[model samples]
Target: MLYFEQLLVNGLMLGAVYALAAVAYTLVYGVVKLVNFAFGELFMLGAFITLSLMAPEISLLGHVVPMPGLSFHAAAPLAIAAVAALGALIDRVAYRPLRNAPRLAPLITSIAVSVLLQSLAQTVWGPGSLRFPDTPLSQIPAVHLGQVSISGSNLVVICAALVAMAGLQCFVRFSSLGRAMRAAAQDTTAACLVGIPVNRIIGLAFVLGSGCAAIAGILYAQAFEFASPTMGFTPGLKALTAAVLGGIGSVPGAAVGGLFLGIAESLCAGFLPNGAVYQDALSFILLVLLLLVRPQGILGKKEMNSHARGSLITAKARKRASMVTAPLRAMDRLFASRFFDSWTFRLLVLACSIAAGLLVQSDYWLSIMIVVLVYGMLASGLNIVVGFAGLLDLGFVAFWAVGSYFTSIVFIDVLQKQFGIDVDSVWWLLYANLILGGALAAVCGAILGYPTLRVRGDYLAIMTLGFGEIIRVVATNWVSLTNGPMGIRGIPSPSLFGYEIGDSRSLYFFALALTVVLLFCIGRVVRSFVGRAWVALREDEDAAQAMGVPGTRYKLLAYACSGFVGGVVGVFYAHFQQYISPASFSLFENILILMLIVLGGLGTMIGPFIGAAIWIVFLQLSLKVPFVNSYPESRYILLGAMLIALMLFRPSGVAAKARLRLVMEGV
Candidate 1:
């Protein structure tokens, strides 16, 4: 019973900080209709800024730098102010330009901003945990009530968060700007027509949200006595989930949701034997279920789901196509011809791939090509979801991971270890598992597709992201099934009829064959009615539904097909790498695949291959540069910058102006 009370106190303390962060998410999302994925990085920056202000000297960008060394009270406010300003600037730079663009444009831009911020923080802070100084707040004694005790830091966290929530509630309720924000949230065009400064109101919301997130970061730093660049990831995700659970736009509801989540997690951890291992996944699991059941949330109004139009891409194809440059327009036209869509061109590409594989004798270069081939497939699969279907799926790698793990466990753990059978003798099982694994992954993808029926835009993105994280968490913790951090090893190599694919050259050939097959299969489908339906959904889902295109069925089918491709790629990757681990399928891989499709071109068959080649080749070439090799995180900054630039100037990407073929296919 005493232990229960302690858990309750701890939960409350945790919930307070989470609620504080949730206010930031709710504030920004309510007014601007964007879930700022970079809000986590903003929260991260708050702690770093506070650390910089309080410390006398610190290592910044690999140099020892002098600091303000201010007291906590003085430094925190300044840090909050700095972060709040940054939050507004982010809105102006990363999002405002994409205001009229597709919703995916802004959402992806936010992720880029997040990547940039995290990488920058890691570079500045040296990727190591920095010890937080023992401030006056930390030095205070604990407060005891009967059998339960609460520390001074916990008290500070609770009181400060509650106070901030109250102050924000009052500000939103009574202030003129708050009324303007509410109006903007209700209808941006209407608010602007009514003479409301919609842009300024949006900026104010970001500022307030950032300030609150900073407060939460400070409170978190105090409680933990340490700061790190990656601290905000899980907390930010949980806070966003809390905001969704309560009411996206309701201030008090954020608090209630946070408390509920914190208490549930704490209790689960206390009672369940392996709950602690699964705690990080709890919020995501809850998020998926909640999105399925009540997407508007407990306190949210129906108007909160105004953007649920069945498609994340909210722009007309012709309008977007018209913005392409003259040169790119010519390229698009050249690629739109019957020759480009024909099997002859595809066969020529396949022949070229075979020639390259045979010519490249070096193992290292062949391995790189193999990676490019796999990633190309990943990009292609993702394009079907994000480009053709117009859904923002952040969890595509989960399917890939599913395929990799299934084949590995079956070949190694089940067939060999359990039955003591030789895997090489039953090489046919490999081919069989490829089909079975892909089918299983397709089923999973369709299950994930359910949220697309109800959730849209950023909400849909979060649900997909949650699914991805849940898979990662389970893979990392379920030692019995996944072998935990040690990972699965010694998987048998793939083989053909009486031939072995043991070398990199053979693997390259094998991978190239798979890539060509995938492209051919994709081409066949995209030229059919399914492809037309996807295009219709991408351009305008409601209109497609009205046209009897069966938006629900086609959307779900896209996910299944995409998953099948990802699964096939995963199966090959497991054998090629000869090992599998949770780390192999990180969120970065998903982002990288998305980047490939974005950089190449959306809604185009060959775009994924082009993007993969450019990105993977750039990565390889970067190794030759000493500075880039040393400062690895700097690459992400470049990536983020590129995404921002592309969004601002060329949201259509490098290979744009995709023309739909009424006959044998191209999108």
Candidate 2:
């Protein structure tokens, strides 16, 4: 009874914070219809800034600076205000311009903003999770009510949350601006026609949502007595789940969903075996199930469903977008010219590649080339799903991880360690594992695609994101199999027949051969009828299905093919590094690969290779900056900002033109 009471009290406190954050999500989602991934980063910023304000001194770029040492009451409001302004600024800078563009333009930009903010936070506050300095709120005594004991901090959090929600409700019901927001939410065009300042209202939504998220973040941090760059991601994800559970665009539903989700999580933590280890994963599982069963959510009206799959472009915006992409279109024409496909260009490229490989005696440059080719393969595989099949898979790296793990386990763990067999003698198995590992990844991809890819792009993206997180979580928690973060080390490099492909130059050559062969095969595959089917799906699924294309089968086949390529790359990656770890395969890697595809040009054969070269080369070159070298975290910030800029300026990418063949009617 005591345990239950304590858990219940704890649950209430968590629920309150979640409810507050859910309000933030619901507010912005109501107006923008975008999953502002940056909300999590805003939440992160709120906590860090509040703590910084309260601290006596803080470190900046390895320098300790004196601080004001203000109290929580004084610092929190300031932090909230600052975060609110930042949230509005972000919406203005990153989202507003792309609002009328294609659905993917803003969606991709939102993720970019999310990554940018997280990296900025990490750079400012350092990468480590920080313990908050002791405060009066954190030191507050627990008050006992019968069997249940509630801390004063928890009580404060709960009371403040209720007041915020109540005030918000009253504002929406009575206030002019609030009413305008509601009207805008219902019908933006109608509100605009009726003389409401839609942009102003949208900005206001960002401010309120940011402020609410800040309040939740600060209170949550006060409870835990810690702040971290990564702290907001889980809470933000959970809040999103809560928002979905209650019904997006419904404040009351958000509150109910948050409370229910918190209590469920708390109870699960207490009752379920190994629950603590898997606690973070539970929300993802719930989200997937909820999306599958009832995406509209409990309180969300059927008519309120606003997952717009089509372009939201207006006439003026289209003109602006076209103007921005004119340069890319020109570049596209350059690539489409006869000179590009001529033998002279091909020979020049081949000669240059060979000369560079031979002349660049330094291992570092060779290693860089190898990395570029590896990522090119990854980006190429992802292009199959996203560019060709028209499925935005945010979790493509999972297949890479799976294949790497499969070979590592088979060669090192199963063969060398367990069976007491010498791995060197059985080097031939590595070649076979490439095919087997790819096959394994193909199966996994098909399985994942079958259940999850039935939804629209946004939902499919969410599902894939969840799938990626699950794989990561499993790799992290499953200690016995995975060795749990310590990682598997000392896997052998690729041995070609008798000679080991161990040197940087040897590995470079080997990787180059594999990359060229894979890309060539991909080129061949994309020109085939299978590729045509995939492209048709990419263009319009319904039209293709109407034209006798098997949407499900073809989509699954794409997943399999892409997975096979990723798995093959994974085998190479494992061998190349001579070590395997979860660190190499992260959520960010997926974004990087996706960015490569976007950078090179979606649906272009040469785009992935070009993107890979540019990304890897520039990433390596950026290290020349002393500031970047000192603050390594800022690289991600730069990359994210570049992604945003790319989405804004070159929505179609560098290779905007393609050698598309006309399909014969009735064929």
Candidate 3:
């Protein structure tokens, strides 16, 4: 009884911190309807700023000046102010210009911003978690309540949270600026017409939300007595879950949702076996469940189901669309006059590239080509979802991970543990694994897609992300099956008719062959009825549904096909590397894959090939360069900058070819 009581008290206090962060997400989402993926980074930034400010002395441009450290009270306000300014700056730099662009543009920018900020923090903080200085505040005594004692810091956190919530409620209700914010959130055009300064109001939303995040950070740091660059990500995600659970866009809903999430997490962790290891997974599970049940959120008034598939058909997209189609029109004229059509020409080009790769006798170059081919295949598969189906899947790595683990289990565990057969004796299992692994991944994909595909836009993206994280968490914790973080090793190399493919050169040729087969198969599918249905769904889900297209069926089909490709590639990866590890299949890898497809051309058939080549080659060459090798992290920073630049200037991508045939017309 005492333990339960203690859990309740702890849950409420933790919920207070989560509530503060949740409000930040709600406030911004309420007005602009943007997810602000980088918001967590702002929370992290605020904590660091407070830490720096509380330092005994500050250094500027190689000069250090003696200074007295400020108390928590003084540092908290300063950090809030600093972070608020940074939030406003972020809006101006990353979000503002892309306001009227395609919805995906801003979301992608947010991701890039998130990466940039995280990378910057890593570089600044030296990749180490930090602890607050042993200050006067942290040493305060605890308050006991019938064996449910609360620390002084936690009490302060709860009190401060209540005050902040009350203050926000009062300000929003009575202040002129608050009214202006509400007006703008309701109807930006109307607010603009009424001279409400919609732009400034939007900026203010970011500012105020950032301030709340600052408070959340300070309180979190205070209670925990430690801070880290990544400390904000999990909490930020939980807070978003709380915001959505409470009813996004509703202040009161966010508060209740936070408490609910916190208590649920606390109880689950306390009572369940190995619950502490899986605590992070709880938030994502809640998010998916809530999105399925009530996408409007618990208290949300509006549906908040903004679709993105066809939303990109704005003026900018049309302009890009025309540019995308121009080369096709020219090709049509050329193909009409020439001996072969565009399709035949493309086949010939592919054949030539394969022949050239085959002609390369050097093992090193073949090894490099193997990576290019693998990523290209992965990118192509992903393009089917993001570029053709118009689903922004951040969890594509989940499929890859699934495929890899399935194959590893079959070859390593099943062979060794169950059958008691040496892996080397069952070289033929590789073929079976390839077929079975892909089938399993397809099944998993169907399951993942079935529930969340119904949700629209960023909601779907977030849900998929959660699904991906869940897969990783399960893989990390389910040690009996996945071998935990140590990963699987000593897997036998794949062989054909007892001929071992142990050489890098042989693997390269093998990977290239698989790549060719998969690309051909995928290309044919893209030109088939199934592909047209996917394009129809992407262009407009409701309209497609009206036209007798099963939105659910096509989506599941996309996932299955994409997952099949991912799974097959995973098998190839496992054999090629002769090992498998969870670390290889991370969220960052998913982002990198997305970058490949986007940088290449979203829906273009040839885009993945070009994009993968450029990215892989750049990475390989960058490491060999002296200056670049000195600053390894600069590559990601540059990539982030490139994403921002691409979104702003050329949203169509580099290889956005004009299609001669329309997939929507069953071409």
Name the top TM-score candidate: 1
Question: With candidate 3 superimposed using the best TM-score fit, by how many Å does residue 97's alpha carbon deviate from the native?
Answer: 1.1
Question: How accurate locally, in lDDT, is each candidate?
Answer: 0.84, 0.83, 0.80
Candidate 1 structure quality by residue, lDDT tens digits, 116-181: 999888877878889878778887799999978999888888999999999999988899888888
Query: Which of the two candidates, 1 or 3, achieves a greater lDDT against the reference?
Result: 1
Which runs in model 2 stand beyond 4 Å of their true positions? 301-330, 341-348, 658-667
Report the Cα lDDT for residue 280, model 2. Answer: 72
Off by over 4 Å in 3: 57-69, 306-309, 312-341, 348-352, 355-366, 624-628, 658-667
TM-score, ranked from best to worst: 1, 2, 3
For candidate 2, list the clashing residue pairs, or say none: none
Clashes of 3: 2
Query: How much does candidate 2 score in TM-score?
Result: 0.92
Candidate 3 has a TM-score of 0.91
